[model samples]
Target chain A: MPALIEAKNVTKIFGGGLLDKSRTVALKDFSFQIDSDNPSVTSIVGESGSGKTTLARMLLGLAAPTEGEVLYNGKNLEKLGGSDRRQFLRDVQVIFQDPFEVYNPFYRIDHVLETPIKNFKLADTEKGRRDLMIESLEAVGIRPEEILGRFPHELSGGQRQRIMVARALLLRPKLIIADEPVSMVDASLRATILGSLLRLNREFGISLIYITHDLTTAFQVSEDIMVLYRGSLAEAGDVDQVVRHPEHPYTRLLVGSIPLPDPDLPWEGERAIGRPAGELGVQGDEYCQFHDRCPYAMPMCVQTHPPLFHTHPNRVTSCYLYRESPELPMPQMTSIFKSSNREGPPEETEQLDALDAELEVSQENSSTPTSADD
Target chain B: MVEETLSAEEPTAAELKETLKVEDLHVYFHTAAGAVKAVNGVSFSLKSGERFGLVGESGSGKSTIALSLLRLIKPPGKIEGGHVFLNGTDLVTLTEEQMRRKRLDEIALVAQGAMNSLNPVRRIRDQFILAYKDHDIDVKRSGLEERIGDLLTRVGLNREVANMFPHELSGGMKQRVCIALAISLSPSVIIADEPTSALDVVVQWQVMDTLRSVQEDLGASVILIGHDMGLMAQFVDRLGVMYAGKLVEIATVRDMFGDPLHPYGQMLIASLPSLESRKARLEGIPGITPSLLNPPSGCPFHTRCPKVMDHCSSVTPILQEVRPDHWVACHLYEEA
Candidate 1:
């Protein structure tokens, strides 16, 4: 079976003109595939400058890659004919981060739901369009009675986003590119919007490209995970395996930063590898992008960039530690000690223990507020 | 000698008295639609060095409360009735000039989207100087650069960052600058509303660390306002769950997370997706927060509360002490 979407050794470079001297590589020889028959969810997890957005834009055909090509059903997306382009658009849909921007303030929510239905001719009559709108709206947990004829300002952010989802559902696209869909929405309503996307994935067999920096939510929703670090692929594998045992140093940092909900399970040990300061993407292009911040940075890391090594059957990590042949006994976390000889494990543990034992009590607990002063 | 004499009596007063105390605070927005009760009879207190979290979804009036604390609520919105006692002085009754002086010196706000709070046109140093001059700080023109550099370094930024414009800095850097500025004056209370909401996770961790260290170093109370329950669990000392302009529950982070008493608080905690556990779907709180213009009679959350009783809809429940430090405003726990 042909893949639904495939990126073949794609690269995107920005700014190499008079206004800009240094070129920023948003994606470096990136390649990935989504099987059309299987149609599962894939999360492109990355930080702010991780080039996940660039990949999404390329996949949507909104932006072209500098090299390689994004293929849809074994056909190049850039080379698609007018008719094929229309079909491709119908097959693929995008849900943006901000819902407020999706709709106009002057128009009613009905305009959003109506456009897709009218353009696609998903329904024949006015009654059919109304029915389709209601069905799609209900699918995203929005009541047509409450939302119809209501302006964008009248509805909440979550409600507006659900309407966007409902609008997407009206097309019944084969794939949905949701770029931080729930990040802008409040936490309470986050699950509902995410649930709707999951429903579209499972129930409707729609493949989803869920892009977010939040690993926890990505792990919760996606089957496959792709971890990116400053335009470079760090690790990619099954969500369960990758989240449990992240191989890449950048992936480990991302996973370690996730704050757990349990108060007793305080964040301790294995701090995030801080981003190296001064001029991003200015480091040697041949060297490992994460070498500066990697806790286990080896001397060879500066000399050569590591290829994507298959650590497990499903897991792939682009790190020198998991190289095919031994370079230097997989550089231990000795670099930290080498940099700061005074600081050791004992002091770190002591600080962790003290922080863990810090009381949840406030100073006002022992004394009452001065309400009498009023 | 004079400074030593004044500082001698400050320790006991700081320890004994609350840094910020808000009692029966009510703020209403007089919109063309109607009177919107943003905050209604909400009372909470933060100690000198306490880290307090105000958690609620959009329209829960949590942000409104934060704004009301700093007296930043603009027109159309009026402070209806309340006593915001910052160091035993009722701020509601204070004159505009007195409040302006008291605003930055006594209580400062690191407003939500603080990255955008900085003027893009001006350099970071000029903004810091402008803020410093507003409160009439004694930093001379020559020494201001060094002072700005010190503040920038405290927030983990390089001294050269003070010379750059807000546009030159990334979102995280801008947020750190905002954090640095909020604590520059060494205010007694810092209301950081959604401080890390817009930043990346790793950046958020660093920004949070910066806030904690600065807050500790300055011995300032922090009112951290955000809807991220997981973040609050790791960051805050106390948690307050708000629903429809009322604080439904307030307790230590331990008790609130371990055993949430109120239904709203319980549901809020249960709804959070944990990173450790891979629960497929979250049991989200049902129904939207009611319209504040004409909120539901009595209990605002009764419309959505799973453990709703007949009397809950008709009678307003006052916040009562359940556990030693835990307070709940639900009728179900009234007898207990």
Candidate 2:
């Protein structure tokens, strides 16, 4: 069976001209797929520079990958023409992080629901279109009377976000890529917004790719999760296994950092890890990207990057500690770490302290905008 | 100190002194439409070196109360009636000049979005120097740099960060710089409004850890205002739940998390996604927050309260001690 959407070794590199020496690898050699037959919710978890958004853009065909290709229905996305392209556009919809920015201030909320119906020709008559709009709005639990004639600013943040979900439902897409949908909403309304998205998969038979920096929400909603670290896949597996028992050092740190809502379980015993300072992707791609901040960095990690090794059933982790597992395909690299003298990992406290000083000096030359825009 | 006094079952004269006390505070914005009571008759007190969290949805007056405490509300928005006692000094009655002098010396503010609060054109050291100059602190030029460096080190940043501009640092580093600046005066009260809301989870933990350490070192009471309940549960000693300009519940963190008394607090706590157990369906609070312009008649949360009675809409419930230390403003706990 052909995949509904697929990314084959996708890579995205931003900036770096003949004159410019600096280039940022937003994503590196990443591959993913969503099956057409099975509807599932997959979460792409990452930090600010983790390239989750870049991957979403490539899947939507908004941006082309520097090296690999995105395939829709087993055909290259860039080469699709006529009906195939329109079908792809209709089959996959998106809900952005900021709900307020997506709507136009000049028009009423009806403009948002009406344009897609007219463009797609989802309804034959005006009455039919109005019925479809009301059905979609009711599906997301918004009363049409209170919402129809109001301007975008008149609605609250939670209401606006629910409207965005309702608009996506009008298209009846097979897959919806929600990028931090509930991050901006208040704590009280987050569960409501997330519940609507979950209903799309359970009741409406739509697949979903939830992209967020929050692991707790991802765990609650997704069946499968992919942890991204600086544009590389750190861990991938079932959400239950990965989040409950994370194997990758980065994944473990990410899961451990979540502040549980129980006061009895205070965050204790975990030493604070200082953030590494420097431009991402500046480190040589041949070495493990996480070795600098990783607590269990071995000598081999500094010499060669580790590939994703199958650690358990339905689980893969990119760490040298699991290199000896039977499922490792690269047999030649496994022996290299075993032969190295087992010395205690270099004292990280002093190195981390030194890096803090270096970070201040290195950032002195970059002219990034400050919080003046806020 | 107050904890020890409470444990003895008797309040001594010295330990009875609260670091900060707010009584019947009312903040209103006089707009063309009407008077929006942003904060109405809210009263709370902070013991010395205690961490108190004020949590609510948007427009719940959490931030307004913070500004009111510091006398930072501008025109159109006025402190209609209130008394903010800081070390027995009523800030509402102080003149403009006196209030200006009192700020950063007795009370300080670590505003949200640290990048916006710091000047882009100035180096980190210059901003610290300007703060010192504003309060007229007498420190020699040669020792000023050392003092700034020491403050930076206390917040887990390198002393060399003082020479770098604000734009050069990352988000976490910038917040640490803000935390360092907040403790420079060693003020008795520090109001940090959503200090880590803009940061990533990993960076948030690091920054909160830094804030916790520096706050402990200074032994200053913190008034943390935010909407994140999980963060509040973990960081604060006592939590206050606000709804439509009113504090509906106040209790120790453990008690509030274990057994929330008010319906609003219960719904808010139940809505949070927990790592320990995943529910099939999360029960969110029904209905939206009422507008402050014309809030609900008597009890602000009566419209959404699950156990609301007939009198809840006509008569307001006063916040009273339902348990030993837990306070709830609900008719369910009120005596006839």
Candidate 3:
């Protein structure tokens, strides 16, 4: 089956020279495919500095991958001509995280909608343009009457974002790259944005590649999930399966860190392990990017990087926790305190109780303003 | 200290907040778009030593309320109406110099975005020392560095790091330094505006924990301004939802999230992704937050409200106590 979007060994390396190693690696040797034949939403979830945005940028053609290929229908995106690129643009529209960025501010609300129409050449006459604008606005659940003459400042953040979504609908694109689309919209108004995106994917069969640091919102709109950490794939699989039972320690910690909306539920116990920032890829070329932070990290992990092995039928993980290869050793403990299973210390329960009461306020709630805040 | 048991049965949030009543507060800005009614007749009460959250999307008059409390709204912006009473003291009536003395000593603010809140060039210790001096905290210059270090350690940061510039520390640490400075004065009320927005999830937890513990240590009431329901739910005891330039709903976090009444409040809670209910599709409130300049005549949320009525377009709803201790301003609740 021809995938709607496909990336093979895509690496986005931003730096000066080979030995310099001054640049940050945004996406490292990432490969994934989403089939157009069965269009479904895929979520790319990662915390800050996790190359999720970098991957989205490379896939959207805003920037090219440093190492591998980003192909649409098996065609090289970088090689596409201006017209073909236009067609690609028409097919793959984007709903940006910040709605303010999409608007020129100088132009009226109608102008923002009208310009997209003119650029795509979707309408021929003034009446046709008006009709097209109305249809696009209506398609995204926005009334043309209220939004047509309004200025960007005249509308709310949620409404402005709807206008952004409406602009994307102007083209009826097959693949919509929504990079934290709902992050800027208000919580009360966030659902409408998610609903609109869902409608686009379900009703119009538009395949969406949703990028977000928030697992809950990402899971709300997407079916498949890809976990990225420090520019490398951590876990990729069915959204429900991966989210419900996260394989990688990083994913587990991420899910664990998510703050529940309920005020009473505090994640005080079993604190998530912090990222040891200074511990950059120690074992030369073959080591998991998340090895520094993994609570269950084994010594063998330092020498050999785990491949993205197909563990669960629909899921894949790049962690040695599932590695049973004969070549790989039953790794002895790297850190003495690896798991809770081996604990035999006295007064451990008392220590755990004290740790349990400290409100884990930041773990799950500390999300970079996705689509909700400026 | 206005001593009222935090667990008292009859201690209503309004009654508690009434010790500091902001009556018919109106903050306006003369922008090119005409008079931007940034805070229009915005009135909410905060009793001494009770955490009250003023929540709304950006431009919803949340930040304005905080600035208005401190008389910090700069030129082009003016407090056109209303009174703000903190501990029965009318803050609006106080002179600039009078307020300056009372600023950190009484009314303190933790500004939005931790990065911008701290002075980039200044050392964290110096800022603390300066803030301490501003609040008239008695401490000599010789032992100021050690005291600053002790304070940083209290907020969960290494004391030695205080010597470094603001840029060197992580977002969360800088926020803690800001918290440390804000708390250094031991102000009666601390207003933190979007304090955790810039930090990472793990760091956010630590920062919030620090805020919670610090609030506990001071026994001072906090008015948190933010967009995250999850964070506020855990941090604040009471919550207020603002729209355009008016507060739409105010209630306990438990009530707001457990059983929301207002269309906007219900929508806000429903939009969140919680662990327990993996509800297949999230129901986000449709439309956008309205602009303050010439906002909707009746209900500020009417333009985007799903259950909006005809009367909601013409008549503004006052913040009324719909439920016991739950203050909501909506036509739907006006009938109730």
Candidate 4:
């Protein structure tokens, strides 16, 4: 079976000025395909400004790519406008990262839940729509009465998120772009929301595009995974394979950085090694997108960028080391990926967390720390 | 796995202890609606160089206990009743002046949301300098800058970052700075309230490792408050399971995972999703945690607990040390 959603060499550049006039590359030479045949999930993992969100937006046809193409069922997404676009929207709904921000505090939960049912004409009569609404809520593990007349604030963070999932379920979209759906929720409830995604994928066979920063959750649900770094494909492959034996340096750093709560683990007991730098993106061609920050960057990496190369069967990575440039020595980038003050507009840490939470790839909201702080 | 029960009267003293002991701590926030009992009759002790974990759902009052420890619980939240003792001295009896002198020197806190804990306008180093001044750490100007740099380095950051404002760094770095601040005075106990809960997987990894090594090196007992059970399992020595406003279980990290006595703890462990088991559909805890204001008749967990007996709904169970070290406040384990 062919890929359900394919972004062939899709690239996007957002300039402060008009499209062609400015010189900022938000996404560069991005390429991947999500198979819809068996209803598997594809997780795009990266830190903030990695162009993961930009890619998601583009995939949903919310934003157009600067170069290459995104096709849905072999049909170009950018060209789909009007009722066709509406159908595309109906088939591919997004479960936003922050459920609190997604809804209005003043509006009752019914308003957000009912909008899609009414807009899509999912139900003919009042009783039908009401039953459909309750079923959707029940499917997402929320009771009809619990969500009936409550405001977003009246619900717990996790409850609000379940409501978001229920609202998306009401549409019964084939593909869901859930960006960091569980990041803001409490720890205990996160697994359930994640479980809902798994349940949806298995039972309903809904193809899921789970954007997250957490690798463990990605490991739990995704069949195939793509690791994004600074708007470039760091690595992509099978979930179990890539996660257990990461091919790329970036993926390795990400897996190594996930801190578990148990203290006996070897990974948790190691001393921290924090190297430092500023502003992650590359302005000039000199630095590898990961240069200055990658633990395994070469001097050559700073002067030239690496192209994505086939390594393990299904995996691909863009690093000079993979090319076996024996003549060049690896100069580590100050860090790998850490949740830093780098992405947000907030001067305080609270706002930084809010910003970190935007939309994590698939279901993981991973971060970049100076991997050097090993 | 049954446990041995010990009464509160038996002082935990056989071992040379400079531990902070909290007894029947009840904290209530006078919200607009009513007096919200945030930390209702909670008790725990931190031994020297021991790492303790406070695990709970939202509104379980873990953070409230942390805030109450430092007297940082803001307006509306009053320490209604409880005795908090640090080392041998009771902090509840101390005046504001004494607490000010003792805070950073004896007990430092790395609060949740790293950046908010840091001052945005002031240079990140100034936050350290201010701490030094506040705690009366006597060192010359030249020596102070180096100390600040060293502190940054200790927390795994560049000394150069000391010159940068909080905004210039990333979330992980800012959190490291918070840990750096918590360690500046070399306190006996460092309370990290939800340190890794805010960061991404990568940053969370970096932050957790940084904290683990830092706590080990300093030999200070740590009180880690987190909602992530996976993280709690990996990072803590002992775990406290809180429900509503009460601590229902306290056990070693291994015991908590291996033999969870409380119904809440068992449900939490059973519900957790792991990388190893993809097919395991988590048994979600049946009902929502009860409202703290008007909690259940007896046990806070009885509403959602699967093993609730008839007597449980009427009689409040006092915290009994069911094992040598593990404590539980459940009637099901009454004879354990």
Q: Pick the candidate with the highest lDDT.
A: 2
Candidate 1 colliding pairs: none
Query: Which candidate achieves the best TM-score against the true structure?
Result: 2
The sequence of per-residue lDDT tens digits that candidate 4 reaches over residues B178-268 is 9999898888889999886667766787787788888889989999997878777777777889888888888888888888898888878
Mind giving the per-residue lDDT tens digits that candidate 3 earns over A1-374?
Answer: 55666787888888876676687778887777655555567788987889988888888888999989988877888998888788888888888888777777788888877887888788899999999888877666666776677667656667788778788888888888889887766676676676667667765777778898888877666657888888877877677788878898888877766667788786541233355654444656577776776777677776777776666656777788787522211111101111112232112222122222211221122222222222
Task: Give lDDT: candidate 3, residue B139.
Answer: 59
Per residue, candidate 4 scores C-alpha lDDT tens digits across A185-204 of 77666766776666666557
Q: iRMS for model 2?
A: 16.2
Q: Who is ahead in DockQ, 1 or 2?
A: 1
Weakest lDDT window of 10 consecutive positions for candidate 2 chain B: B1-10
TM-score for each candidate, following the candidate numbering: 0.87, 0.90, 0.83, 0.85
User: lDDT tens string, model 3, B202-224?
Assistant: 67777778887888898788899
Candidate 2 collision pairs: none
lDDT of 2 at B40: 84
Query: Model 1, residue A91: displacement in angstroms?
Result: 1.1
Off by over 4 Å in 2: A17-21, A268-283, A326-374, B1-16
